[model samples]
Target: MLYWALVFFVVALIAGVMGFGGIASASAGVAQILFFLFLILFVVAVVMRLARGGAR
Candidate 1:
């Protein structure tokens, strides 16, 4: 998930550099949304792990 967000971010940057305004904006939006979703999921996973005593 985080990987995808990074991919989209890179794509957005490239598109912006290439002057693809619409594509850049859309990719940036997707990247932002995916990043937040990934963050939320990561936090939840960490909390769950801690709740489970941090066992491997």
Candidate 2:
């Protein structure tokens, strides 16, 4: 998930550099959404892990 976000971000940068405004904006939005989703899932997983008992 995070990897995809980074991929989209790189795509957005490339598109922006190439002057494809629409594609750049769309890719940026997707990257933003994926990054947030990744963060949310990571936090949830960490919390769940701690709740189960931290690394022995």
Candidate 3:
């Protein structure tokens, strides 16, 4: 998931450099959504582990 976010981010950067505004904006949006999803999942997992007393 994080890998995909990074991939889109890089693609967006390249597209922006090439002046493809539409494609860059779309890719950036995807990257942003994926990053936030990944972060939310990570936080949920950590909270679950802590609740189970599995902290390390």
Candidate 3: what lDDT?
A: 0.99
Global lDDT of each candidate: 0.97, 0.98, 0.99
Q: Count the backbone clashes (under 3 Å) in each candidate.
A: 0, 0, 0
Q: What digit string (tens of lDDT, one per residue) describes model 1 on residues 1-56?
A: 99999999999999999999999999999999999999999999999999999967
Compute each candidate's TM-score over C-alphas.
0.91, 0.95, 0.98
User: How far in Å is the alpha carbon of 28 misplaced in model 1?
Assistant: 0.4
lDDT of 1: 0.97
| Poorest 10 consecutive residues by lDDT, candidate 1 | 47-56
TM-score: model 3 vs. ground truth: 0.98
Better of 1 and 3 by TM-score: 3
Q: Which residue pairs overlap in candidate 2's backbone?
A: none
Best candidate, lDDT: 3
- The order by descending lDDT is 3, 2, 1
- What lDDT does model 2 reach? 0.98
User: In model 3, which runs have C-alpha deviations exceeding 4 angstroms?
Assistant: none
Question: Which 10 successive residues of model 3 have the least lDDT summed?
Answer: 47-56
Query: Cα RMSD (Å) per model?
Result: 1.4, 0.8, 0.5
Error of 3 at 56 (Å): 3.2
Q: Which lDDT tens digits does candidate 3 get at residues 1-56?
A: 99999999999999999999999999999999999999999999999999999987
